[model samples]
Target chain A: MILPGDLSKIRSLEEVFLIRFRLDKKSKVPLLLVVFGVMLILFAILNIVLGSVRISLHDLVRVLLRQGENAVYDKVVWDIRLPRTLAAILGGAALAVSGLLLQIFFRNPIVDPYVLGVSSGATLIVAILMLTGVVLEMGTIPPYLLSVGAFAGALAVVILIVAVSGRVKQVVTLLVIGLMIGYVCGAGTTILEALAEKENLHNFVLWTMGSFSGFGWEQVSVLAVAGGVLLVIAYLLCKPLNALLLGEDYARSMGVNIKSLRVVLVLIASTLTALVTAFAGPVAFIGLAAPHIARLTLGTSDNRALIPATILLGAVITNFCDLLARILFAPVELPISAISSLIGAPIVIVLLMKRRTSL
Target chain B: MNVMQTKELSVGYDGRTVVADINLEALKGQFICLLGPNGSGKSTILRCLAGLLAPLHGSVFLKDNLLYQMDPGDLSRTMAVVLTERLSPGLITVFEITAMGRYPYTDFFGHLSREDEEKTWEALRLVGARDLAERYFNELSDGERQKVLIARALVQEPEVIILDEPTTYLDVKHRLEVMEILRELSRKKGITVILSLHEIDIALKSCEIVLLVKNGKILASGPPEEILSEEMVAEVYGIESAHFSSCLGGIEMSNSGGAQVFVLAGAGSGAPVYRLLNKYGFSIITGVIHENDIDYYVGRALGGAVVGEQPFEEISLSNIDQAASLGRQAEYIVDAGYPIGSLNRRNVELARRLMAQDKVIYSLRSRQEFEALYGVDGNKPVYCPNLGALAQRLSRRKK
Candidate 1:
């Protein structure tokens, strides 16, 4: 019979480790958020200044203030680097928030937009538009139409996955089903690629490789509006998301309308993934890795802290990865997905190995 | 007043009824338990009552309000539940988890108000988990985790709290502590506590009302003492050999048929000996025990032949003669060394007569004490000090 007085005397080995590390304290969240905020600013600045043309910080600041003398440098800063930087920030934050939502919804650490095939569904629709050019016969296809198509395809796949999730309770089984859906979409994209004209096929292949190279203000605005609204919705859902950590039955008992929460979570998550995939052509790993980074750095599972921290970390890491993609191969400009996978995959593996509880 | 009541309720999954025709009422401050064997739909009944599952027929009323018709937020504020599901929310603190019970009351951001925080701490203190407030939820032991879960339910401050097998994974000490906490909550705080449990003895001692569920229906419902008859338990649990002794508040396994041992025991000295002998497959015949003695209850529960006497009556000649005839057929005799009061003094004479028949006797008393007490000089019984020594001697003889 352990009395209340005896509980403090009983120091388990796990408690000893927790005390030594001081990892479970809620006070650490604000400090970690400040650190992430600084990192995000540094990375955002580096992304703008260290592009292929190598604009200096003074010239970049002068261009941003609209007082630059050099036309080429000003154009490079305002038209090229600035738009790509904003795109990376918005897209990364959206994908990360999407991944966090899916992870919590499925109650699995490995779930994300890419793993659940939301990005592939969007990719398939965009591939059909780019490779086939069926609508090009009428005129040049509007980018808005592509975004709409991608949203439709992504929503379709999300609806399908949600339907299957209801029937299949096992997380691993649902993951496999998502992988199978991705394969079918990939096969469709491959068929279009095999039959396309060479010039169109080349552009389609580059798009499939996933880069933030040609992001213009038009794409940036779409990402900002859609991703910004979805992020606010995600933030508003923090309370129920925290309740869901105990799982669905407990969450429902606590008065969360689970069916509607499911719809809202999948809608926001898939739309965010579709929006990013529509403009940036399916960037990888940021969605899957950023939430885990937030969890590890914050050392807590409270969604109230994790949501904003994940947004900052995602924006910073994606911008950093995009900068690496531009600089690593110099004139060649490697795919952003390649750099993101190289850095993000190893970090995710190490983080998962270190924390064995949340699987 | 009745805090929660159900009428003609049937619960199941996907339209298939698991249990039907359940009518139950829980009054304020009443501790109610659903007692049954495994797979008897105890959890189904509880889930239905908690509004997690819809009943197939009839309605559940919470203070004149329909349970199924109430809003989820209102239901949550009025009732709380502790389920058997294991939680592993990563890196959440105990205080944070317990404060989750205020979910219904918290605003859109779920920020804890001063009152919410105070209630959270109060619930933690009530469950004796305040010391663990700073610790991670996953780092705590199973018992501590259960306490934290209960604290979470308590923080809801519901009029009624329901639990589905809250003590399933706990050890004996934690089981008692958790039950005591629930018992106190109902008794002192006036919260109607409802739970399903497999521990019949604990339910019998602690619960004010018990619903015995079997197959696909509730077999009976009433106070545990009035409804939990020996036959009812045997029938409900499908026991063929073991006996549930209401007086002993536990079940005793049937004794195996083996070598006969006549034990001269009275009072409570023979209970442990009866258990040890039953464990070793010895058919026990204990004698001259007054009807009200604790040994008589244990001996009879173990299916041993106990020679009985009226309460507070002297051990009579007829009882001695019957015991001596029974002892003659035994391969060995045991003197349990019960206190020699005037009422049970004939038990010693029976032992002396059995010893004179040249029977081997294992006596707990020493040789001098046995001879002085029996007033015998030639025939003697072997002195074994304790039950362990006697067991060793008995096993050797059996081999």
Candidate 2:
């Protein structure tokens, strides 16, 4: 039994591991948040300045203050590069938090937006719209209609998966079912692409490859707003998510209204996935890898600390990956998915190998 | 008034009832054990009472409020549960897991208030798991994990707590320790506890009320004294060949081996001998024992044909006559060497009766020892030093 007097000794022992340079043990999470926050800003700036057209950092700063003389450089920084960099950061954070939420809701580390087929469902709808010429870039179809279609398609799969989850209690079985659904959706997408015109097929294939290039302010604002609102909802669910880590039965016993909570969690996760997939065209691996990186770095599973930590790590990593995707081939840029998978997959494999028995 | 009551509660899945027509009333501080065989719906009934499953046909009331109708927030504060299923603790610490019990009372963010933290630590200490607070939950042993789960439930500070087979995976020491903790929790803190258990002996000893369930129906509900009969256990568990001894708080298999032996025993010396003979599948008949003798309990529990006498009385004429007939029919006689006095001197006479037949008589005392102690030199009995030596001789004789 622990005496009241020994409580302090135990607490101090814990504090010994928590103490860092000038920070007390309690301030560690905030300190990590500040470090990540500042690093994220720096990486976002580096993404903007280090592209093929070398815009000096001074010129970029002057353009940002709206006092620059070079209109072409200002247009390059503001119209093209800034939107793509912001898209990478916002989309990355959204996907990462989305992954964290699904992992918590499903109580499986392997679960992510991509693994649960939400991203594939959204991609399928967007592909159908893009390949069939119904969502043409011309004035005939409002482009935002594809975003709406993606959201609806993602939500449909979310509802279906949620229904199946209620009937199926096993996590691995649900994951397998999700993979099957993704395969069916992928097959349909392939059939639609086969029937499309050659020019339209190029657009569909490019979207399928997943890139943050050509992200405009309109797309950025939508992702920012949707991602911001959904992340806040995910944050509000942190406590119940912690309870859910116990299991669905225990969560319900704790008054967590499992049915409604499951729906809400899937909705938030689907929205985050749909918003990113709609604009960035299904960037892969960020959702699966970012939350894991956060948990490993923080050495804790407290979702209150993990959620924001994941958001920052995801943004910085996505920005870094996006920068490499643009500069690696110089004139011939690689797909954002290719870079994220190349970088993220190895980190995930390392984590799994390090904790071979658990994952 | 009862703190919790269920009226004709039927619980199941997919509209099919598993355990039906259940009625129960539990007082504020009662400890109830749901005793049944595997697949008897003990866990289903427990989950139903904890409000996880909606009763198929009837109502559960908590302090006169309909359980299903009560708000979840209100229900969570009033009741907690410890299920038999093990949880994946992941990277969480024991303290964090215990603090989850305060979910209903915490703010929207689930931040632990100072009082909540104190309560969590207190609960951990109550279950003697405070030293495990900083350790990762998955790193603990099964017994420590069970204690941590109990502590988690205790942190809820609920009026009632439900557990499902909480002692299944624990060792004997841990099983008793967990039960002892629950017993103390209910008695001291006035927290009503309802748990399903497979250990009949432990349940009979720890629980105040027993609900015997079988074939998806409750057979009986009352204190273990009235309801935990050998017949009731046989019917409930469908063990036709096993006998339960509520006095001993244990169960014994039926005597199948036909080897017969008459034991000369009294006081407490014959108890272990009776058990060993029963264990070896021997059909045993023991003679001339006082009703108050401790051996009488063990002997009767193993279904031995007991030849009895009244307490403080000498061996009666009728008892010796019965012993002689039974002893003559036996292959061997066991003289357990119970102390002889003036009142019970007739026990040695019964031993002499068996020796006169030239039977292989086994005594815990040796031949010269028995003759010097009780018998005459001319009518001596073959005697072994102890039960082990006697058993060895008996096995050799069988070979």
- Each model's TM-score? 0.91, 0.88
In model 2 chain B, the worst 10-residue window by lDDT is B373-382
Residue B168, candidate 2: alpha-carbon lDDT: 86
Clashing residue pairs, backbone N/CA/C < 3 A, model 1:
none
Error of 2 at A194 (Å): 6.3
Error of 2 at A342 (Å): 4.0
lDDT of 2: 0.84
lDDT of 2 by residue, B161-182 (tens): 9999999899988898899899
DockQ of 2: 0.38
Q: lDDT of each structure? A: 0.87, 0.84
Give a tens-digit lDDT track for model 1, residues A284-304: 889889999889767788999
Roughly what TM-score does model 1 have, to 2 decimal places? 0.91
